[model samples]
Target: MGKIIISENVTLDGVVEDPTGDEGSVSWFTRIGDADRAAWAEVEHEEAVGAAALLMGRRTHAYFLHRGWASRTDEWADRLRALPKYVVSSSAVADAGWGEATVLAGDVVKEVAKLKEEVTGEIVVYGSGKLVPALLEHDLADELRLMIYPFVVGTGARLFPETSAVKPARLIGARPVGTALALLTYELVHP
Candidate 1:
């Protein structure tokens, strides 16, 4: 069975929203130096290469599509372009411009449970802020890989919101990737 991994770029305060500052919100993504960004990128690339598939919410998918990730020829973009993608959205995707994607619009828990059984390796979730809490609540997420930036965005969408149920996890790995980033890996401990 595939492990559903929540891979998120987070601030020290646990905010997951507007990491790139594209939304005109507080962002720590661009504050890091070039070397730090490069290191972070390397870690992300490695994760992308190792993942079996990419999973995202509708808005996250749209965000990437809007950024034109589909047309980029870089290695990272190539990896993303070739990976199998799944989108969880109630509405029909007008265009999966990134590539072919399986849309799960039914019961979130049931659809994800079915997906977990169908694949092997890691099904990595990125920037699915709205979908993550549900995944955690349903115990659908098997692991969490957080790329933590040094600073904090005082108020924003968080990977784990205050309203979410407490989900226990044991840290499996923690390492400083560069001057300003830390890579923390944890495995969900189901009761």
Candidate 2:
């Protein structure tokens, strides 16, 4: 079965919402120093090559489709545009115009499990704030690749919700990049 990996950019305080200022707040972009840019480049390259397919939530999909991954020639755009995309959403109506895009409307766990069985490479989830907690609840995520930024957003959507159970994860690797960012990889331990 393929591994389900979550590659997310989070703040020091664990906020994951609208860091690029495309969704709501512009604070994250402004606070991102030169060091943060270098860290982001490393994280992006790692995720781009590691993932075989991209799994996203509705909001994230919409945001990225409009802003980041829309152009075919953008950096990391080819990988994103070429990879098969699975979007979990109840309200997203339009298909992602690049590659094979499918809407997973059934039980998230069941659908993801089926995908894992069929796919060959790593099934990656990026910035799927709403879907991350659900996947975690179902024990669907195998790995977590987090790029921890320096600044702390006092209030915003978080990567992990409070309702989630405390699950222990083994640290697989850590790389300090730029000045204040750390690329941390963790493997989820099933109990």
Candidate 3:
């Protein structure tokens, strides 16, 4: 019932690995000021309010959700903590710590399809690189939202991978997030 929404921050080259140079992507993301962070926080709040559930890969669960959102006291953090989460993982994690979560350690793609049949509203997937490939390949993801940054990372992991099947996306909306970010919403035009 719920649509799987793939949302991420990407450079012009579609690199979503790590915007901050400490990890391996671009370095400009670190230079943004309070206004930029505030703008991004607003977007997070809006998305959290609209999202019905959280779906992500293991790395996203460990690095982003656990290390990031779980420690916050904000409304968006509250929403994320309260929402039901489905993590696509190869190994079972008994303590994901982020209340109401399930690890789909077996056949992630198939399990996610089943999850889609069970839930309603928007199931947003954050930075889940490994799981995203399967979702895109299987045509399970319904919507794709890219928070396109100002620059490009010439050599890094890209958002769009090599695929034999054509994945068409029709641009539904585009808006600026402060001076540094451009939010682009696209509906996955599947055949």
Alpha-carbon shift of residue 3 in model 3 (angstroms): 0.2
Q: Weakest 10 consecutive residues, lDDT, candidate 3?
A: 92-101
- Give the number of the best model, judged by TM-score: 1
Residue range 10-74, candidate 2, lDDT tens digits:
88898888887765675675566776686677668668777888898887788777774666585
- CA lDDT, every model vs. true structure: 0.88, 0.81, 0.84
lDDT tens per residue, model 3, 24-121: 55685666678987898899789989999999888888776446667788788888888888888877754445675688888887799999999999
- Considering TM-score, which of the candidate structures 1 and 2 is the better prediction for this target? 1
Q: Tell me, what's the RMSD of every candidate?
A: 1.4, 2.0, 1.6
TM-scores of all candidate predictions against the true structure: 0.95, 0.90, 0.93
Q: Which stretches of candidate 2 lie over 4 Å from their true place?
A: 91-93
Candidate 2 positional error at 74, Å: 3.7
lDDT of 1 by residue, 105-185 (tens): 998899999999998999999999888988898889999999988886798877886644578999999999988789999
**Candidate with better TM-score, 1 vs 3:** 1
Best by lDDT: 1
lDDT of 2: 0.81
